[model samples]
Target: MNELSDNEALMMESLARGIAVRAMKDHGAVPPTVLIGNENTVIEYASEALADAAAKDRLAQIARLLATANDATVVTTILESWARIAKVPGGPMTERIEAVMIMTEHRLGSRALLLKIERTEHGKFRRLTPVSVPGLDSVQGRFTGLIPPRSPSPEEIKQARTVLGLLGLSPDGKTIRHDLN
Candidate 1:
């Protein structure tokens, strides 16, 4: 598949918002203007009631409270209160609630990349850093031993020959030749 373009990304964002709205409607959630924003773009879900000064003020207060919270637990607590105030019902609201819970959960390790720095003994010049590849965790059992062996069928061999031809491989499979003058 091809990579997603900017327009496709926007369309996907719209689809997600539509699904959220539908879920909210199904669960009888009070309709609040849903807003999705990034550093560059801001998309608003229009609602007549959300235009009120009191509602806007409350939203601002909630936003301020969230901004003050540095820890995940505090942030989750603030989000939960905000969701309650917004009158979010079951389905999509449940998803939002779970998201908040995940945000608050303890992470197993740091997501940031680690860097190692080295300095010369003479202190004349220093190199920036080097990175080591992380090792893969070991799996529990040997599942391959339990599985059955299989051989290529006639159709598979035919398809393989077609692919080889496309790659300019000889039909007899004797040698590989490169185009040259």
Candidate 2:
């Protein structure tokens, strides 16, 4: 697959932010408190595929502390450790893992407090909003409040059929023939 271009990356970040904000609202989590609790879960799950013995051992220790202690220090250490691990140099998989951790940090680090809107050309407005999702730095403007048309009345349908028939189309719209001599 082709890598995301600048525009695509920006769009992806915007989507992530919107989704994260929605998730936080649904969970009733206040700003800076992510719904995905227990940082240790991240450490354990992220480290599960590691083949390095030292990394596994380190993860085991972090898991043990997370399982037993409510100490703020332990929690902070675990979070920081995961953050560092997320930065470990590797390939695409490693980059993805790091992105997850970065997103987690964003979600748990700030609360969206304001929405700013600006007018653009063509009677369109651009809205800039904050979101909680990782990697999604800014939410983009969207056109909203469009009302769908109601179903057409019988008279309207009949009129449409008449128009189609006049166009040399069958009532069922399956047959058409044109001849010039």
Pull out the clashing pairs in model 1: none
Runs with alpha carbons beyond 4 Å of true place in candidate 1: 1-19, 28-30, 33-51, 71-181
How do the residues 1-181 of candidate 2 rate in per-residue lDDT, one tens digit apiece?
1232233323333444454345334532212211212322321122233346665554444332222221111111111112122233342323221112112212122212222222247534333342123433332211110111223355654655565455454333233587786
Give each model a TM-score.
Answer: 0.20, 0.19
Candidate 1 per-residue lDDT over residues 47-149, each given as its tens digit? 2234556765544333222222211111111011122111232223232111110011111211111122223575422332223223211111211011112
Give the deviation of candidate 1 from the true structure as CA RMSD.
26.4
> Candidates' lDDT values, in order?
0.28, 0.29
Top lDDT: which candidate number? 2
10 residues in a row with least lDDT, candidate 1:
72-81
State model 1's lDDT: 0.28
Query: Pick by TM-score: which candidate is best?
Result: 1
